[model samples]
Target: MAAAVEDFAPREIVSSRGARITVRAVRPEDEDGFHAAFLRLSSESRYTRFMSVVRDLSEATLHHATHPDATREFALVAVAGDQIVAGGRFVAVPETSDCEFAVTVVDDWQGHGLGRALLTALRDAAAVRGYGRMEGYVLSTNLAMRKLGARLGFSDGPMPGDATTRLLVVVLRGDDGRAAGG
Candidate 1:
């Protein structure tokens, strides 16, 4: 059965640097924090994550990020005190057993393992929803993200018709037994 939104209660984790952090489902109340985190991302980070030179998060993007549908869309955020340090999410692909996933960590928090935690949470959430796989389109030049995805069991190949992009996928276990992430 698909897990409900309430199933994703807040949980705490310690980063590689030993900083305490909380990981939880993104809530409507997180709008301001999300905005702040977006603003704090470096231009290169923004471009790599969004595939564009986004100067700011638009209202539409904020809504999509914060107001995820409990079933088909799920999002997670990692917080240290009052600030969002990282975020991850997966959205079900229509008419398919796969979902698209994404993850981002604040500039100052990139090397702390928060990305792994956030993605793990996302993968668990998607599994409960019966998704068979999770995937993302990453920039071919983004070696850091590619490396992270590889560590999480994702396999990648060049995105057809787009030499600058690659598709990364991780199989998630379904009833038939397959294997899922952020």
Candidate 2:
């Protein structure tokens, strides 16, 4: 596992359509804004991100989202003005040098490159942590994600026993010029 990283420097990025957004690690004070962003997501947007119909985030899930374990998990948020516009995270897989990633952009921010920015951050962070691989499970109908995954060098295939889901994976190399896990 990687060492605890309490925070990261904030970065400013321009969306494809020229919107300025700041990307930063999630903080405790972001809970309310994060929830508001979720509420603003259309039902279809929510379903695509969650792969299920989630009207609201559970208290436990909300807390966990805002408070990632410093050692094995990293979460980030993209903010425009005072509101959250996107978020992403990667959680280490137990006993393995691999991480599972998830990313979501609010409906209005979709198709504007926020998701790409967050996913890139997660992938780079995991690589820096010496993770061997990063993987994501996306719904089969999510063509945007599939295309993004492909463009980012992630290979995708059907998830075992899940017809509606596809698993995307990319091997990561560490500073030593070798594949991370083995």
Candidate 3:
């Protein structure tokens, strides 16, 4: 069974620094807040997240981010008051029990456990959605994300044909918390 948007309810959480934040599903009305969060990211953070130097998000990109397909994709944002402090999402791979995941935290919010919170939620949601595996591409030099992924049970390896990038993967199923043949 597929999870609905409503499955992602707003829940308050405390960051590692003890800052209170609410995690919830992204909404169309959050476009401005989302954009504002993007703007708060430093150039290095933007490049690491997008794999490119993105000064701004295009209209189509914003639309897609704000309006994820409930059946094949899920997204969540961590809000600290009116500001979107971080966000994460997963997109199903066509005809496969695999999904691609991504996460981003504003410069000021990094290292405060927002990435862990968001990624853990995404992993659990993907498993509930019946996906057997979750993975993401992270720049090899981004040691912070690599370390975080390792802590969350995601294994890292070289991306074929792309040495500068690392492929991070985690099995979402199996009694041991890792599916076979993944």
Candidates' lDDT values, in order?
Answer: 0.87, 0.88, 0.90
Per residue, candidate 1 scores C-alpha lDDT tens digits across 1-182 of 34456678899899999999999889898898999999999999999999988999888889878888876788889999999979988888988888999999999999899988888888778876778888999999999899888988889988878999999988887456645222
- Model 2 lDDT per residue over 81-168, tens place: 8899999999999988889999989988899999899898888788777788899999999999999899888999998889999999
Best-to-worst order by lDDT is 3, 2, 1
Would you list the clashing residue pairs of candidate 1? 172-179, 172-180, 173-179
Report the alpha-carbon TM-score of model 3 versus the true structure. 0.93
lDDT of 3 by residue, 13-75 (tens): 999999999999999998889899998999999999999988999878888899888888899
Best by TM-score: 3
Task: Please give the distance, in angstroms, between residue 177's alpha carbon in candidate 1 and its true position after superposition.
Answer: 5.5
Give lDDT: candidate 1, residue 63: 84
TM-score of structure candidate 1? 0.92
